[model samples]
Target chain A: MRLPYLLAGLSVAAVYLVLLHVGEGRQREAEEHAKQGHVTASYAQLGKAYALYHEGHWPLLDTRNRHFAYDLGIVPKGYAIKQEMEKDHAPQAVLFGKLGRHAALSLVPLVDFRNYFYLGFAVTTEEEGLALAKALRSGAALDRDIKVAQGTGTLGSSTLYRLHDDIVETLVMDGVLARQDLTLPGRIPVIVERPRDGYAWVVFLDMHVEHLRYPGPFPLTSKFVDTLESDAL
Target chain B: MLHERYDWLDQARGFVVLLLIVSMPTSEYAGDLLTGDPVLGPPMLNHGYEYFDGDPAITTFIDSGQALFLLVMGFVGYTAFTSRLRKRGKGAAFWYCARRVGVLYALASIDCVLLELATSGKPKWGDFFYNGTFAMIALGTLCAFLSIVVIPNADRRMLFSVGLIMLHSLLYAFPFFDHHTWYDNILALPKFPFGTLGMCAMAIAGSSFGQWHAMDPDNPRTGFRKRIVPVSTAAFVAAYCMDWVQPAQHHDSNAAMLLQAMYIGGFMLMIFFAFGEVGFRFPLLSSLGRNLLLMFALGGLFIGIYLDCFPKEFLLQSPYLALLLGGLAPIVILSCVAVFLDRRGIMVRA
Candidate 1:
């Protein structure tokens, strides 16, 4: 009876010790998993920076690079680029443009395309708009058979145009000429600000882009120009 | 028959038992109210002042009830030990005493219902109703015991008592089966059907022992002493062993283990002393144990209400006078009420 009791006591003690050790080990493993998750999040942020660089849109590329660098504590001295960029337009708008550009560029590498093209035209004057169109046609980077369409006059203003094709699309209006949807040459986007307060500013605006239609005569039509002023207001 | 004995010892014992039973559930709430720190939360440095800024009465009630219950239990235990012991006929008298307990239970039930209605449904019906039911059941148990000891039909007595025991066990375990509150499943019934079974078993067990004593009066103390000492020692040992094993979970740590062991050990000792040693009978002390149901119910309500009202400091103070008063006030009030009813012969039956 004494031996049996002794043996049972020893066995239970051994089991408890083993359980303690196992519990400690599990706790350590959980800590390691948490560390791994943090590292993975940091890597994702770095990947975003690399994509920004390839787009050649230095304004956006510089800003993202600096933000990540600051977060990682690698940059002892903060970069003054954000202060400079804010002097021109809203920081949010700049961020949105970069994100949109990056999304468009992601589509490029998937397709077996060699070159990507973008076009812009101001609709205020027919002559200036046609001149820009001629310039796009003549450019070595653009495809020869670029598709086009046009918008209709909804209000007093007449100049609104929508354009699209197998290779490229354009929406031109007064003070604006938007490249409707063109993939960047690589899996990254070029973030360039439209000339501030210039006639080209409308090219970056959403109203002209939304009115852009497809399956028409020119990549952009006279109707696109007619709808421009009404859409802008 | 009006028996104006007014035994302070008995009344005090009852008061303490009632306080303990009632306070068990309220202790958790009181801890929360006084500390302002919930059992599971960050410790509250300012006590429950922030949480219970508007409610002081509830805090006072809890503190007073806890302190008073502890005092009464301690006081009664001491008084019963020093006082002269009473010797009575074991078999028939035990049954008769148990049945008489039902009247006290009925009065307790009326008090419970009044308290429940006064509390505006804050306290659970189970807490109050279970007390009355347990008392009634205790009466039935006494009857069963008397039948076994006085009647000669052994087979019939054994069968009936066995059935009652099984039925009572089933009722106790009903909560596990239904996976619901014990009150709704067991206490909610009009006759406290499950508890009655336990009462019947107790009665039978009491009767069996009583009859054995009656048959063999020579050195009756020897037989009881032989069983009591060994069983008490084993229970104590078991409690100690349980305390030695520390579970891994923080909630199941050494402190909890020890507390649980002590509780079990205390219960075992109480049982052994109450039934095994007949010559050591103290009516006042045994009555407290016998009326555990009623006392527990009243204690629960008082504790619940007290915790709802007071802060921890009132109960945890150094001199302990505040704690003592806080705990004792409710029991004293309730006991006074019980005494008045006892005098009037207005016994309650659940």
Candidate 2:
């Protein structure tokens, strides 16, 4: 009979309506903050430094300075980049996290919305940041994407490192070891770079995530790359 | 002889296979969560589109696919068992499947062990005996085989399915399941496969569907839309609206299971009817469905093999292009393999 199906349908509908009401506020807040102006504003106070690397390695840039053609989808609050750091670091957990280790890591979700980019910074005691840098230089767990080989970038010795078949690339600065795990899976074309200083960065482009399952050529490609290039922290 | 090409089943399975393959790169199994022991095999190992970074839509979709897989498993299992019963008799079918399920269990155990060795240097006892989907499949088959053979009455079988799931649902009411108690790991042993009442319930529902399909004189193709469209639409709407479930983040939660059923059931009805005309028109998906196990294994290895062997730096320059290609890698390889297997009549049922 249709009884089981009907009851299931009604129960499901009722439950969902209640849940939608509860989550509406969070959804609206996420949409409001996701505005392009709100996102780029985070770097406004930092002056032009956020845009240029080492005073002038790359020119200052602004991205998505306008509308989000189709709002991708709201990511639940406080969801971390554990997928990148945790899964990637599972093999190296012994050497990475605890107090006296190779490097201390800080993974940040750029905006509260968390669709686009996740930034990772590894700070080491003393010159160990450089030591960690050297270890990264070894390319321990990553594969080199030969299509865009080292020194292929317009910038200083810029190279790309990726796990095979992966979309996100470790955009190694001057060939410094980039964070292998600082990735936004499914959203490729994002950059994971480490500059001359001990600081390492992950600039994820939300365009890939937002535009997937929709239309062609993925608009905003240039905007994302420019933002990453400008903010190659 | 292979069952007259059940176009819907083939497409359904191919769809499941496609979902699994795509979800792999996008989702990473929670190894940290898998540590110690788990009740439902590390939250289904599917975090969804953002590499398990909590993409709600994709996560729900994946969950529904998995649940439908269980349902299909029961339907197909019952169909196969009944067909075999006519040829081999009821007792023979029963024992034969017992042995068959044993083999499946052995393979599942080996898979778990190998996965552990691959990811973590050391393999645990649980890896060999209990882990991931193998146990779920093997153990679930055994449970269904027993239920079908013993409960001959259809009405009773339906009640049994409902009762079994309700009993399973009680495990959650216990705060013990929620925490990291020492016993939680110990309890996970029995929990493999038939341990979760929800899983058993799903299998029963599937078997019932299969039984119905076999007996019904009405053309399934024509009757499908009339019977399924409304139910499926309702299920989907209800499932999409599910927010309290946090379906993606917590795999073992009941919400995840319910969402999976609704999504899978609804999507399946829509897809089976919509793509029926065109889906099988492509030879690759059909044959891949036939030789699914092999293609699935091959797909899982697509990335791993690439990581170990090739080193392409150019992919990063154009991430979207790389992503587009990455999605295509499995399809291309599967198509090639499907073509090879289809031509040769090679099929791996398990």
Off by over 4 Å in 1: A1-233, B1-102, B117-176, B180-196, B206-220, B226-309, B313-322, B327-350
lDDT of 1 by residue, B1-350 (tens): 11112233344445346535434433443344333443321223112222343211112222222222322222222112112122333443444454445554555465566655776755434534443443434344445434544654433553454445334333322222221121122112233434333344434433333333233346644434553234335534643453333211111112212222223333333444455444444343445543444556565456556555545554455435533545555556656656565556554422
Write out the backbone clash pairs for model 2: A145-B312, A145-B313, A146-B312, A146-B313, A147-B314, A148-B313, A148-B314, A189-B319, B26-B51, B64-B260
DockQ of each: 0.01, 0.01
Weakest lDDT window of 10 consecutive positions for candidate 2 chain A: A66-75
Each model's lDDT comes to 0.34, 0.46
lDDT of 2 at B112: 69
Per-candidate TM-scores read 0.32, 0.51
**lDDT by residue for model 2 (B1-350), tens:** 52456766766667667777765544432223213221111244354333323224335456555556666777778878877787768787877677767766666655666666788866665534533465655656776777887886544675576555434333332322431111113122224222344555666666765665555555665434443444446545644544443333224424335545744654574576467756544445567677665666566656555533322344435656445554456466667777787789887664
TM-score of 1: 0.32
**Docking class of predicted structure 2:** incorrect
Give fnat (model 1): 0.00
TM-score of every candidate's chain A: 0.22, 0.20
